[model samples]
Target: MSKSKPTPPPATPTPREAVSNAKLEELDQNREDSHGQFLTTNQGVRINDDHNSLKAGERGPTLLEDFIFREKMTHFDHERIPERIVHARGVAAHGYFEAYDNNASLTRAAFLQPGVKTPVFARFSTVAGSRGSTDLARDTRGFSVKFYTEEGVYDLVGNNMPVFHIQDAAKFPDLVHAVKPEPHNEIPQATAAHDTFWDFISVTPEAMHIIMWLMSDRALPRSLRMMEGFGVHTFRLIDAAGKSRFVKFHWKPLLGVHGVAWEEAQQVSGKDPDFHRRDLWNSIEMGAYPEWELGVQVVEEEDEFKFDFDLLDPTKLIPEDLVPVQPLGKMVLNRNVDNYFAETEQVAFHPGHVVPGIDFSNDPLLQGRLFSYTDTQLKRLGGPNFHEIPINRSLCPMHNGQRDGHMRQAINKGQTSYSPNLLNDNFPKQAKQAEGGFVSHPERIEAHKVRARSKSFVDHYSQARLFWNSQTEVEQMHMVKALRFEIGHVLQESIRSRMLILLSQVSEDLAARVAEGLGLAVPSAEGVQINLNVGADTDPAPYQSGPAKADTGRDSALSMAVTAKANAGKESIKTRHVAILATDGADLEAIADLMKALMDQGAQTAIVATHLGSIKGENGQQMLVNGTFQSTASVLYDAVYVAGGAASVAKLKQDADAVRFVNEAYRHCKPIAASAAGIELLKAAAYPGATDILDAEGVVTSDDAQVGELAKKFMAAMAQHRFWDRELKAMPA
Candidate 1:
């Protein structure tokens, strides 16, 4: 009977028909509204005029009957919620996470189960800034992740850099207060280059390692997706067998690590304060999901004393070369949040929020974080029930006898809320460790209450010196400049000298250079005392050695230069914004092919024309301008391409903006491409004999094929990110 009904031949769509079908489907999904449509109220009543509202007369007192005006005012009156004191400026996204393999041996966390995909919400933020602060500020970025698992919500609240400034949690407030703008003047909005910060860092020698990192390029990440994240504290990984191991969490970005030069970073802040945020948002929106691999370095309980530094020291890090990282999983952010305020703003992350198999260590800084995060939320989020917010809510069912508080969204059914109640048959019983419940490690301990830090935690300069010796020459120069800038801003000369002395303890050369810049003599080293109550003084001299010579063959895992060079070619240059400078009459064919090839390869191409309109091509075609030269600068792009037409070359040669664009790009060491006509313009602008002219080097030329080839080579050079080897003679020393 089924065969009797002859099956119709399979309908195949023609190429044009398929395209038309797609257009029709898109049009159906998105309907256009008529321009003449009348404006309506929320109730759908067409309004003839809304300007005057429901007034008695044109100039008379407005009546209370104006429901429209009342509704508008009421909504506007309550548009804000308390902003986070730290990590106030943040961007969030939704994504899924999958473990590389079963991590049951390391921990029993369900999300890290083999082949199991868990949904995650991650929020990246800048600390010590307001909601509207510039994203390019040299501040620590918060890398907080909320995993919605079957067990419960696990928040890995971390920072971009692995180490922290203070060793103890008790000093967190003091450290934060000193770094934040001074209470009296409030001069700096989101800057740490000031007197109070240097003063605090000078006293807290434990901050040396982190301070070195802060001054380095790590603080100026080119994009959020290019930065590494660290838990910043030693955590306990409890296995199913109750074995506890100290673990430090790491998030290695798939794009590798990259940073903006200080000059470029500052310029980007002025050009686009939302640079990082926009980069992330656009990447995810375009299906280029940002990814990071989760890794952990575990230290066994028996080997706790095998290292030079205390395992409980939050300021220390076990070098990756010494203790290799075990990659557990990969997190790919694929979705953007629907509502920023409800999701990004309301979501809360606490280092204390842990599931089964995850426990805390005695790291003093972490102990303080446990208290600070919860306390901060109470004040910032306006209630204890912040967990009820959709973004913060646990995926697993939650039940407790706790009574309602402000903004409570749950309603309990039973009258008897007690757990040991016969009336309700003890419905919500607590699960034991045997039944997949969270349990603290049973480590036997005995201690006398003390406020002092361990003597073993006093060797701060060794790692600081390690960091100093590890940097590449270019990175070292940046660090020196950063120190000069930060210390230069200090109003008090004494504070600057104290910092310079501290710098000398790290490296005499570094201290001397910074001191010279600040017009101060490098102060003598002040002996750092370690009160271990031993027979002899445990002086901090062994670790106070300055920079290791190039021949010393010593390298530290703490340096960004080593970290960056470690993953050089692996970084993706996709979606990197490159501004192509052009005018009305340019090499339209060469520009078109270069732009198309780059765009197809996922690199963003923005046409920077003299004005925001159509520019004539060599073949009589017209190209729509993406941005005007006045609205953009060389710093806004990863690289610059000077491909103008013969007709436009004369004007470009005389144009100050054009000259500045080329000069800035050259000074920044960004890769530049030029056609025959564009080369004339470059020559007019004094193209140095040593400069790597693409045309003379057989890289870029008039032929379309050569232009395409040049684009590929230029992209490879752009991926190098910078041409630091370029002799920038004109740049200020």
Candidate 2:
């Protein structure tokens, strides 16, 4: 009867609805327009058949006269750019770095001033993987951050591990080539467990330090947010008075360093190729921003040589016991990238991108990176003017005489483009030292011109031994298993034999365990030419580089068990996933109370079941299932809970998938709990008989009266993250 039309409902947000929409508005252009519009050509012409191209006739060759077909085909053909040479697979985030105190005492860089927040674009990547490779590849992780400071972009390019595989930059290409897939057939996509890698590393003992780290749990990160980042090179921090201190940069994660089991990492690669990306995106959407504290091991210039190993050595690390890490600032990644390709892929980072007070050291590997990063970006991003890209643009003012190149965004209008000109009154002139000019630290370097590396860099195995001696028994066992897994994959017998001999140089026990896994005897190192002083034909005996000093004390920082101490006392489990396993006839009240307590502590609870959609509850309440057992697995959740109701428990116990879910979670050492009759499900899963799991370790099983207390006890266990000691008891998943 009424001619007036009903008002249209408010437009819904994007798929990631809970994200910071206010920040999204800052990105200019057609996000809103594209959302409600129909598909169109690049020129905005409406298109109907995007699924099929125009042809001469049905199933015939297309004609060049069809503008829509040609445009679509051309765009798709050039859609991809050259992927990165090393860090090909990656994810990025936008964030800000805030200085905790005035680090003016160490560096005069304005970004390090107290309370200054500098915009940052950080990229986390797996080195040596193709763009389409799985994120869980067992390889080095590249952790690079670009701080868009007032002076310039200061990039702290580093890795998850503190050390590197080579001492000199000259050996970098060779190292990458060796670890990459075989030259004959690119067989392995993203792995180092091959013959060529072992063959090259057998003689290059300088890699021993990094080898230990690679085989350890650090290489397999649990989450990008939980990984530790290290500036692998020793850098210099210059003060106002021109005094310099050798500093080792470190990123101490707020969540603490932790990693998934190797078996679980493999499982994740198959179940969810985008597990890490999804985790980070979901965490940010839930308002749980990842955080890390920036710290530095500041060594006085006078004390640089006090340690046995050279501080400038890329393959070595200064133990935390010698110099404690001082927290200078903190970095919080609060936003995900708007465009993956434009921001995460095109953003280039280099060690040379520094401001006033931060300067480079003589680390050979770092020296090479200074030039390689710029060169690679030129080819991959298509030009030198890539800085004009929004994500890579500096937040502060930028003025320079640099003119147009490929893909240039700025149009300069002047008579003169070169410096030292008077026509434009020397416009865009350089700043003086006091006027925020960037001046490299004037370190004295008078030396003979020769193609020779410093002999001080020769001591590699000392720190390698230090790393081995520092690991806990659990970590050490993981390394042993990892080594066996890798060496077993090698096709050549000599490579495996050489590996056994080389590993003996680290530890006899380690060598023996790995040898047993390969079903071979421990090979003798008598004929091995370890390092040989970089092929100079020097005496191989002295070049062996065994522990320089056996009395070196263990460093707690080397172990995740010690580094994760902070996580053990954290108040909440924000962003942690908890799976609520239930079936038809599940108790409605008990499940609701448990979810409330967990949600109050910031843990996300998802109701997982034998099937999707809704499940019938005992109280006539319908429960919305988040996912089904066919879709969700134990590895996806931080913890698991079995809801009560006699019928629900009986049904779950009879279901093999449900039994396996509980058993697998137990096998992975994750915290598990049950309420009332739900304990029967755990018993049906064949839980190990150690103590009454009701209160033993992280497994909590309570009857009806104690259901209220179960939530409290469960959250506390989840905060600790993992119940690692449960690994002592074996169970079949």
Candidate 3:
């Protein structure tokens, strides 16, 4: 009864409280309810569709009038401060691009003309990792080059992988958010092996192709100098006559495509978090410049729809087997940054930064990037004057009326800030198309305003199957191991089971193998909602996927093994690191001759002993030790050589670190060379085939008389990159 009396109608808010209550109610109306409510803009305007940006048509270029996309992308681009939302961790070098020949028919880009040496600032980065993250993370590597061309600055922002995770740009934010660390816990930094990432992949069927790449050895590059780069989106090459051809850009490393083992990558991450960065810096310091041949896969406009896949789909790639890559030029990264923060950290790359000839396709992803990149630079580099930064400044003259912002570097002179003003007589006027000015290809587009994906981008698993079929058995096994490790880390049984179903579409063998590792059965695809982007009221039948299409079954260029064979030659071993295990009383004559022979072949040699500093040779001569057994691991070098001397061999046999070093080198399938008493050390370390060391696949053994032959065989073995056959018998180091 007392409680009933006290429960008089709730007292009305006081005047001040009422006013604050009114404001709270106002904010409550603005707050979005994500449960059953429709998607809306930040301004609370209901969105008809949020899956695709407004385009001229289903397959047409994205229209600039799309305010929804602009606002959404503008928010995504500024989500992080100071560092980039993607590709935050990076390393850079000063270099130059040299054209092979003048072929104006393909493109009129001035930098592509023969004999022109255009200065370029090339930056390499790992996506999905912070600036402080380890460089060896198994993720997509960013390969962006800012070409300071005579016309203007052209940034070829691409990745080591030829394809992307999503087909449209509208889902870019979603893709990034899922791959990033979970919002609630922020665990598992610099990796995609988590429930959130797998959850997104399970629902997004279009990501099948990129998921294959991510779970391959390509995700763990052996060195920055050895990985290939690709412009993921299909672009256009416009000639002077305005002829447009669909083209895919490529950067084939001169050192050839190579990757470290998943185990090695993990170890390197812990041992040297800056493994790739240090390798790039040291190689440059040693005057061993990294080089890559600029290649392009050109497709005629008329033949765009002839292939089984769509050229405008970013998830699909025009295989080199289908359309051969043509060599256009060479890019050599020769100089290290003078100041990392000033040059490397401040450098901004945008796909929209193109010269006259290079232009964009209607690829939805690229179209979204065109708007996102400039917006990203605005927030990250502080305002709109980022182009004024010395690292990003164009060599060509800038005459736009635009001026003044945070960190403005240029000092403008006249009072005529507006265009067409009589004050300056339109001094900085726009040039005609023929006055070496930029002009877009006059391609006609006809369609109605729409927010939908093209039917052409529907088949998501064909190219993924093609990639699986193209991989060698060894490579496939490695991919299986990678998938096992990644999916195994996913704690959610539902997510893991869903991913297995998705993999079954790619290859039954792949899904089965990965399923076996996870101790889970491959679930049936039936009853599973494969596509989550469909509107609640819309029919999900059209969005659901069917059987994967089969076009080109396999492409050899997709396999690193085939690429290594194609690039095998004398130049293959150039800039390779070789560790020489030596100690006091080592063979002076043999060690000196071996170092000279290896260096002559462009291979760097480092003397690793039980201790640092000079070690006394058998002849009482002193030799400097570049590193110690405790200081360096076999993962730091490409090959190992044990010096021959009774005393040195005995000392190495008794040292646990030295024994482990040789064992690890053997486990990694790297070349090993030993001479006379050094063979005893190999046997003691239990290196594979040590009893028959001379006949081992990657081991070279010799007495003093055959020292020259030993060096020759070792160089050949090193050129092979790795003796993968030895992997079957490898033991954990």
Candidate 4:
């Protein structure tokens, strides 16, 4: 076997469309700039008047000869098409993926080569929700991207989580059915905190590892701009020399991974159902584009079995400790979709849509997705011609004999469409590997057809324990609370009892803490029988999980707080939304100094007050308010800053909404800063007692309103994301 080092792969013709910023220019050509253009009909005919359609008279009925109205109305009437079955609710943005260095050594994928800029359309979604569902649901976030590379549109479809619930594709439908609203009532929507879901989790041993992740804080992403995405299954990267190495793909946000508290997520969902959608759109429109670095963990073919767990198992991870992730490139989303229906809703992503160097692994889950994605698009997009959609169309010229689908856009002029024909001079012949044609990695395989899983997949609990041991104390406590909240919603007592036993297999402490919240004792594992009646005819006893090994140690990367706490500089606060609470008679100097510093660091600030328009300072300075008490909430911002003004603070003290804003920010563990008279507001908020008010963990206060020391201290606290150490003493807002 070849060693797992960067080596030149077999040569293939360089693609014509593989030039830097080619997609950006291509997209710009299609962009319409209405600044100096006249209003026109669909056929580009200029219209003298748009407000009123052609009619017999000023008050007469509109005539059928008015084709413009008819065309406009017809298109508007059919604007909406079918949403995706799984990832129905989603938001997408246009960006370019830039390679850091020539990766021709690891893989001959043109987009991975040095300095190549591949245009990309990334769609973030919440699975198990309808097109109108809230973005804050506790479900897996879909992180699918369509990379318009020279070879083709290579789609790297994945999720925010690295692991999945089921190990095989065959169980995908069953898993979805269990997690979705129940067939009888269809009661709960976009959540896994119901009986049917817990029932499935209680019995499926393969779901244990994913359950640990689902119950963690990762599910509650603070912002789409700050979440980490994973390609989940093991894939293959082929060198030009035809050598292949198993690889896992990762997307690390430059802003650092962060998440909101569960309580805050739920409240935000009610207040603004489009929280994530609005956040992403606003950030991009503000020119604060979201960015994520593409990374990979590569393993040699010979070393695939070196790990205790099977690399082919979709429910497992290679643990960053075992194989470190190497950053290869960066993807920045800079543009929003022009039309939601034409682009965001219609883009089809497939794992099968790969470039020359990237190929598929025999991972059961990946194999299933390869087939499912195309089938889904065919049905949902109204035909096999879904790829003809502008968003899905590849930048590279496509010439295939396949034609005439339900919605054929390209009008073929040639009479002869067959191959090796004299009529059309045998046009569009297939190119070889030397001429830019895709060549799959040649791996020798000798295997018998079987329906059984590999024996290596049977050890399911060890890594689960490793993940359990990896979390920080704050994260672990959050997991316990999540389990309690989720399992407590299960109406059936037996389901709750079995889940505790399974949790015990991972950790007694975990099960014991969750059980205490449910007012139940931990069930004995010896007497428990694993349910294997999931439409399968097999012996259930063999599948009953044994206790995890004691050697299952920690993988520090599993903890979000640990990783986030380490990220420094402007990236930590880039595009962070901060709310500055102030009123009339506030010190304009303090507010101006604070806002200027925050904006200079790339953090967005909003002046929030009891009313909109402008508020007057004591020094006769006028300040504009971005939002009013009725328009905004604390859940919308990352941190809160109170500007000093004796008269301003005195008036704000009378308003219940202003007091509640500071209180809620503190309860959420967000950084709170105040200065001079602004200190009165912090005192009126949380833990309002004895000692010093200026020295709290994340609280920054100053008597001087110039904001010199206060700004620096506040910036440092905001970088921390959350003050988890204050969780124990935090009172309700």
Candidate 5:
């Protein structure tokens, strides 16, 4: 017994240890032979002459016994799932939504009840790209949300823009085809600035409004959380009293609206195609939950014609100044999905999924979406049992007589599978209206069957002009720049000229400016018209005409300048990322104190060393470098801090990236802070003198208590987002 002592008892693994062991086991299971192994059939019989595939001879005809090759080819041929026709390239997150206030009077949706927390899944996407395409494409972002309420799932399938390219769903496929890469070459991916896209816009004049929006900064949003979401089509809200009202749903971001410039957007794509996705994921991980306030514009059923534009037109939008959006509740995204394919990819959203009080309007585009979504899921998910997927499944109990579909997850226990059966006591009975069941609003309808669009839907330019008029001077400049860039890419002169003519209908100044940029003359329009048999004289040209007066003040809401800071009173540099440009022998203690104070206020500080390694501080303390001067640019940071020592200043003077970093920060109107030693570095970079340079407005010059004061001032300036008052000497006059 002593000679054959029992082996020591094996130790039980901790949770972390178990995970590590499981990973090791997985690796072991995946281990393959380094040297070539004998080829074998499915039945484990080794084959000596595998290359011959059981043929009669090396050069003779192959035999039918080569089942291995046949099976391999069969699996290879069927290794793809049908991609979503739209929203193919998408990123999704899991979150929860809590209503700020009760919206029972508006709708009886349980999720909108005050204090009721409902889990939500949101998917952001690019419309035209395939599932495998890059993320940072110049395209509209689909902002769709699925709310798993106690009642059922409510889907708000919307886009970043408030309006769509087409008003009618009949033209949806055509629009998508035109914007998609040309079928022959498939040269471009996730772009609309091509011959086919321009050609489509040239013919469809009604697309002008959305085209203008697409060409603007909105299409290149800085972040998904910074953009607004809208249910482009009008829908109906039926109250408990059976009172129906025409409504438009809107999701206004708490961060306010912001966008990246075209040049920056392009550069970001190459630098990081996952820039937006990473920003969202990191922000959520860091506890900066994205939030949006839900608002709705309600119009009585009888007052639908009160607006100058048709409410049913998907291309039209009701300006907030006109009817005003009544704030309903707020939605906060506080979670991230654990799995992409199992959750994000498998989740399906349909506009047809409405609760008891929500109903659809007569918007033709919406009517078509109702049919298209369910049809797409059947093919994309491989069967009708997609609802069984965890992401798409409703939390509420579901019962139905239908069963035995492909990939069915549930097992029916009862003998009866049909409704109205006496066998199972008819347990799954239909719910009545009193039981919070869905019911379509009954309304009188009388119209001749026709394929033509309504006369009211023809006006496309007045709102475009209104939008143009409302923009601030800076926004208008950006819009002009956008127009020039998009039209400049047009290879065909006819397409450019046609677009200019359409622009002229929006604004004469805009048309002339764009025409001048393209080196083309603006063409006079003969006034296009759409024929409708409504017996009323409807001229589409009048709709294409710009507003009589271009001073509507709608631009106030359109411009980000007006909505930059959510809380004006509490404006501080909290959460702002500041770049500290430093080198060896920099003011370590002062920099440390400033950074600590910033971090205490929720700000993030990153040290940009001359190189990517440990840098010696002024006190001979080594600090781990966060980034290099060349790798991290000033454009990526909110503010710049220069705390150089004599040695560091001399070293920074020779570095071009260090010089450019300070200069670019100045050019972008960001706050800059410098110590006495840092001033010489700034002078070497030829930074223009500012009032804040010597005065304690934003810049710091002293190493005393004034340094802390200067840091506070700079932080306040950073919260201002931008300093437009700084003169732009580099701009062309």
Candidate 6:
């Protein structure tokens, strides 16, 4: 008799092996690298001439009988899919999130266990733009992350701004349509600076709070890695004992929050429309991984009604002063996508995608998103089986009684697909709560459903005033300039007048500053209609929001300057791009010394010369040129450094592009440094204290100091990122 085969030992997966690579392994089955392969049709038939389609005698019209041509043309015609109505311009990356410690007391999520690493896919995009729009547009950015956990996929779909323009999802379409280019002309692509948007904002007072953010520097991020992200809606975190606590999600970047000036952003758009996308991709490729800490503000269920603002309101934020964010874990994005369309474009995210420990609150906007996301994926991805797409599939085992639909990828082998079937002996049964099944929190609900909102959501201007009050003087001035630039584009004078009325409700000082720019007076609220969102027959008096006092007068957490100050101790020049302006005969010691100092601190440097290729140093040493003045601009870098040499300074002083570079960097409030003869070049440019500079003037230069000492002072200034104090003395580039 043949010896019976010994039963193989049970296969076991480590904690990291189970969750970190399951999704990637599944996707690997479909991944294909076209290199070293013959070109073939969809059916694996080798092709001859993919460039030219089958035609009659090479010049006549294509023949209908050509099957290969028909197949190729058919596929090409349908290659394009419907872009998202919002967030059409996006970039994504692959990463892993590692928990700091086990917190089963707070959440039973397996991914949140101590030292557990879960793979994640994150996408960042600008709203109000098509797939072809510029990445530097002044708009809200979508910051959505998908965690491939052991239990299931949990999506945290959020935005760079903590608040939204509307309180309810029902009004989302209207808001998008208004912010989009006008239907008649389709002008002003990828921006909200038009008559229709301001007209809609003048009526929707609930949008005032977010409108303030949209008009601030937060709307113009310097890079994708330097901005903060917020979940924007209140969610619930249920413990093992079934107790639920209110939670708000936040993503604080390792790099402190930073933004470009309005004019600098415009220049970046003109020079490189894909500025943010290219920066993210190049950084990851160069091993400079971007990182952010995952934090959550947790509040007890009993304290929900304690805050002056409703926790369910989407247009408000719970100030960190009241409930400080607790650090939970950290996320590091270290990989770029191999194929943009297969992964980044096809990935689907939904606010309703939650594991056992995480749940949702009764936020109107959140509730609306639950239904809207599924419907959108259905229409955009071809059917109900969008989850079967490799990038969107859950890492856990998914099984149900559901049958095949369009684009279904799963195959059930059993005789029965129903739960109570005897043919298959009732296989693939459901799990109990103790067995890792999700059980919704049993919070009692006894009230009847209504079409109206609670009175708690009406205090909209209070948070708006709080945000306006929290900004520093320079930040406030920038906001005023941004408002002037946006509102000045509006052709309707009445829309401008209405915006002034709304601004007055937030702060009279804000309104007056904006009015001064537009050459208009602050409109009176007594005669203006502040509640145009009401129905034709409904009374508008109750919907009109009056100026209310802020719960926390002015939280420092709302100010980027305050955040930068707090992060000063931990700040470094890591991943910062610096421009070293030089030409032939530049001082070799000064260039090598500063470059080495910057590289030692994890900073990146590019030598910008009069031309590409190599430039000769004063000591006959050769240095490679990364870019020329014509190819790279001041807006593309974080700081400017002038390398010292007699010949280099003379050439730079004569080159108009070099002088313009220094002038623009000064105008944008970027750190500028020079050494020895480099100071002569700075004098030729237009900047304050360039003739007789001090270390404190943000223009780091010295006549008698050692090169090492100058490098130290320059790096210290670079750590500050930007010197906003010089903004007031800025001149035209």
Best by TM-score: 3
lDDT of 1 by residue, 98-198 (tens): 99775989888888888889999999999978898999999889998999988999999899988888766545655777888887798788989888888
The sequence of per-residue lDDT tens digits that candidate 6 reaches over residues 523-604 is 7888665644344444566557867584438888888877876776678889889999999989977788889999999899
TM-score of each: 0.83, 0.86, 0.93, 0.87, 0.82, 0.87
Give each prediction's root-mean-square deviation over alpha carbons: 21.4, 17.0, 5.7, 20.4, 16.7, 18.9
Write down the lDDT of every candidate, Cα atoms only. 0.76, 0.79, 0.88, 0.83, 0.73, 0.84
Better of 2 and 5 by lDDT: 2
**Which residue pairs show backbone clashes in model 1?**
586-645
User: Residues 381-482, candidate 3, lDDT per residue (tens digit)?
Assistant: 888999998999999899888988798888999898888888888888888978878888777888999878888888878889999999987788888998
> How far off is residue 292 in model 2, in Å?
0.8
lDDT of 5 at 54: 28
Query: Model 6 scores what on Cα lDDT?
Result: 0.84
Better model by lDDT, 3 or 6? Answer: 3
Clashing pairs in 5: 470-555
- How much does candidate 2 score in TM-score? 0.86
lDDT of 2 by residue, 1-733 (tens): 8799888856986656636575566564444555767667789887643322333222122233556544554443233368876888999888899997758899888889889998888899999778888888888899999999988788999999999988755456657778878867987889998888888788788898899999998988888988999999999999877789999999988877778778878888998978888888888877889999999999999997798888877899989988899999999999998888878877888787888889888775676566556666676788888778877777778777788899998777767878888888887888888998878777665443333455677776677778888887777888988999999998888888888876777777889999999999987777556543322333345445554455556898898866665458863687789999998989978888899888987789999988888999987889899998889888888899999999888989888989999888877778899988998888877555644455446898788734678888788888777766555555411
- In model 5, which regions exceed 4 Å deviation? 1-81, 131-134, 527-555, 565-574, 669-671, 680-706, 724-729
Q: Superposing every Cα of model 1 onto the true structure, what RMSD results?
A: 21.4
lDDT of 5 at 675: 74
Please state the error at residue 513 of candidate 6 in Å.
1.1
Better of 3 and 4 by TM-score: 3
* Better candidate by TM-score, 2 or 4: 4
| Regions of candidate 4 where Cα sits further than 4 Å from its true position | 1-81, 420-422, 534-538, 688-693
Q: Rank the candidates by lDDT, best first.
A: 3, 6, 4, 2, 1, 5
